[model samples]
Target chain A: MWAITRLLAGKDLRVEMRSRVIINQVVPFAALMMVMFAFALDSDTVLARVAPGLVWLAAMFSLLVIVQRSFALEAADGALDALRVAGANAGGIFLGKALALAAQLAVLEVILLGAALVLYNSHIVGSGIALLVGTYFTATAGLAFVGTLYGGLAVGAKGRETLLPLLMLPVVAPVLIGATRATEAALGTNGATATDGWPWVGLLTLFAVVFGVGGTLSFGSLIDE
Target chain B: MNPLINMDTRATSTRFTSALGLATLIGLGWLAVFGLFLSPNDRVQKTGVRILYIHVPSAWLAYLAFVVTGLASAGYLWKRTRSLTLDRIAGASAEVGVLFMGITLVSGSLWGKISWGTYWTWDSRLTTTAFLFVTYIGYLAVRDLGGSHEQRARRSGVLALLALVEVPLVHFSVRWWRPLHQQESVAKGKLSDLMLFTLFVGLVSFTLLYVWLVMHRQRVAALDDMVDDGGLDRALADRRSEGMP
Candidate 1:
């Protein structure tokens, strides 16, 4: 387990250092999303009300794209094939990867928050930002946790470009609900807070644990592939 | 060559009856022609409610498909028996789930226009059903993972179990997330005899569609597998016997 963790962290760190792919992609994607959103709305009042959810949503999307790239790097290098052949534990591998993915997403979210602060004219690290951070971490944990599972499933396929969204969007709806609502609540809607979203948080957390555990359990089966 | 099909019993096409397929066609035709176009325009919801027949049944099929997929997926993993029947069940269920979900989305939106004075709303039922679309979409995604048969099956089995989370989440997210969609009154419990009877029949018809499609697709797959296996073995033989001889 420790070995897998080291490999996971090492592999992602190496990639991040060499290509800086996630930063190049996530930062730009998130920034563009914010700009487009601001362009569409162009209202300061509306921006304040919608900013938290927008930040979280854009961050979530940026992170999803990041997760795929993370896995795709391993896939292209045949690292996954080598890992399975070496008799590495599937659970450990998934854990290591999920951790790294979460870590990378956190970094991206911070950048996104910074950009939004300057661009959207909102407080950067305020309570709303706190809610955004919490929601991003929780929802992203669920996303990466599930992402690794699907990554293995979609590791090989034609038109995989098409498959990822079809496969991903629906499964992660709960995260969107919880994160968006929690963000909405944090921004001071009378009834839209995580107080209600706490259950959704609970749901997102539950989904993460269940699928993460299940994905790890079944990871061995994909070892040969 | 694994000795499973060497029992000398030739596979037959009896199960592939024209009659059963025709009967389903007739039933669907009756529903579309009579039940849909011929049914009353509804008392409360008016023409808008007519889409309910499509929406409700589509939602029903989506849910049923999830349950069936889960069951068959469980069986495949538990026994590791490699049954074609179970594989077909999973395959059919996912496809039907997606198709019904598509219907549910479209008809729901169309219904929403007349009922809610808009084409879209974030109501709870709509949200869950939309998520329902995602759950099975993931299943369909899992099915496409390329690998050897056993490996694919094992991976998909785990996915099947994981995707079941959407079932409760979809069903409850309505009440869970206070949206425009009404809380369940009849579908969950409060069904009048008229509604229940129509729904029961609708459910039966949907199930029938599922069964027929699954069996047909299974037959096609089994045949394709047989042809490939036979061709490979014949190519390898030191001497050609069966078809060559």
Candidate 2:
């Protein structure tokens, strides 16, 4: 199971690396969103105040793109059917795809964080670094697991492009809420202490674990037909 | 023709369904009288509190409907209990649930404007309920994504299960995010007995209405599946006949 997971994850990563879609298209898109937010809000104070939310919102929108790309890759070439015929463990396939998505999202988030700091002039408290990192890790994992799960559901369906976000965004509300609040606390904005961030991180972790285990168990049945 | 397939063309009525519909109609009539004219208004909210009769029941029935959807979806997913009937029930309940949830949101917003001086709030319950509504709408969209009945059931069943699990997490996360500055109570204080009775009537009527709607909607969905299957069967038969000649 672990071997299949690694092999699949590596294959997805290699495809992503060679294609450079994330670097060329998605990163610039995320940055453009941050800049757009700055223009829309039109205030340094307001932008800094809401920077945490804006950052997560941008990450989430980028998540939609990356997830769509991930599943589209499999479906375009009937790779999913091939994997099933190859008799690879379904759970491993789910985890592998989620793992690759998480890795891509992690890099995107780092750039998003940097973009937020530079564009919005947002400042992170020194002592809250650990909390900030924790928020990114747990929230990214939750988003990746859920995105993969729903992506699989929508993969072969009609109008999947529109359907995936509709299906995924509402379900990811917890991650958005938890991540935004946690990021706000970590950045010491909205008068939230670093201590306030931990609970939100816990919520993100819970979301990740529930979807991770559930998605693994059910992915086979979902993609079977 | 398959007897089961042939049966789909018949009207989806029975003695029990007729009885249920009649009870729902009578209950709704009684509820309207009690809720609108008979119940006393609160000292604080006055007439604004009247909307709660519709709003509360709609919200309650919506939750109940989604729960039914989840259970039916689960039944379809489980191999031992799998059936298209369960899938139809799931889809029907979700559609009704969305209707009621829309009523809940619109009425709640109107009520909020009357009382809170705003049509919207970042309140946890409101936000979480909105999330729930959207999730199920997506479920319904997946149902319409063009597939065989079993394909629809399998995909949507997984989605229903996942969405159900996310509800609590969405609720608590939103709750903790804001920490609810207002008391968030249904009423300012304890309700008068008459008011309570009216609310009870509302709940009962709305629940009966939900059952009636689901029963009819499930039948409609079954007929829909039959038509789809019938079309495919006919097409196959035509192709086979051409080859035979």
Candidate 3:
């Protein structure tokens, strides 16, 4: 199972390396979003205060595109069918695609963090950095699981391009809420306000576990012809 | 009795639904007369508290609708009991659930404005309810994305079950985050006898209304299936005439 997962993940990454889509297209899009958000708020101080939220919004929006792109790669020339014929386990495929998507999101988050620091003059060097990274991965795991599952479910759906986002954005609300709050805590802008950020991390972890396990178990059913 | 011998399932179900609808209408009228005109104002909220009659019941019904959707979804996905009937029931309940969720949010917003001095609050209940509304609206939207009946049912059933996982999380998120919305009222025994009675009447009536609506909606879905099949037949006939395989 692990071998299949690694192989599939490697396949996705190799394809990505050759195409350079995430580097060339998605990263630039994330940078553009950072500048757009700064302009939309039109105040450096206010933007700095809200930088955590802007960063999360940028990651999630980018995630929607990455998820779609991952599935779109499979749709070309029936690569998904080839994977099935090659005897890849459904669970492994789910995990591989999700892992690949999560890896891409991690890179995107790093780039977006730089953009936030550069554009909004946001600070990240603090004890809350641990909390921030943990929350980002947990939240990304949750997003990647659903995004991939829904990507497959909606791939053949009518108005699929529009359907995927509408399906995903709502389910990820808690993740956004958790990631944003946890980011705020890490940045010390809120100063342990309302509740400490750990609970939000706990929520994100719960989302990650639930969707990760649920998607793995159900992927076979989702792809059944 | 042979199961298929005399079963006019739609006719029988339609008759039963009409009776339930009539009972619900009468019950709602009773609730309105007592809740709107008879129940005295709260010391704190006064007349504004009356929105609870509608708001609370809608909230309860929305959850009930989703639970039904979830159960039917589970039935559809499980190998032993999978059937189009379960899928139709799941779809109907989700649509009705979305409708009640909208009512819950709108009525709750009105209630909040009078009491909390704003049309919205990030209170756990209101926020979660809004999230619930959006999630199920997306559920209904996914249902509309065209597919073969079995394909649509499988995808939708899985999605429904997944969405159900969020209900408890949403319910407790406020408690986990900050207590903005009021906690469960009936369970806490916070209401007086008359107020509780009014709430009970509203709950019972709304539940009946939910049953009636779901049954009618299920019938509509069955009709939709017929039309879809007809469309497929016409398409196939056209293909045959075009000398295509």
Q: What is each candidate's DockQ, to 2 decimals?
A: 0.50, 0.87, 0.60
If both were scored by DockQ, which would come out higher, candidate 2 or candidate 3? 2
Pairs that collide in candidate 1 are A170-B134, B123-B180
Query: Candidate 2 residues B1-245, lDDT tens each?
Result: 54443563589888999999999999999999999899998899998899989999999999999999999999999899999999999999999999999999999999999999999999888998999999999999999998677888998898888888989988888888787756635466578889889989999999999999999999888887877877777667667768884
lDDT string, candidate 3, B1-245, tens digits: 23322333535265667789889999999899979998888889988889999999999999999999999999999999999989999999999999999999889888889988999977776777787888888888878877678977888898888888876666665556666566676789877788888988999999999988898888889867866777666566657769854
DockQ of 2: 0.87
lDDT of 1 at B131: 72
Off by over 4 Å in 1: A124-136, A187-200, B1-19, B22-41, B46-55, B114-116, B170-175, B183-199, B227-245
Candidates in order have lDDT scores of 0.69, 0.91, 0.84
- The list of candidate 2 runs beyond 4 A from truth reads B1-9, B181-189, B235-245
lDDT of 1 by residue, B81-187 (tens): 66756765787777877888898898888877787788887766666677767767767766666555566566677678767765565455455666445666464
Which pairs in model 3 have colliding backbones? none
lDDT score of residue A54 within candidate 3: 92
Model 3 Cα shift for residue A129 (angstroms)? 3.9
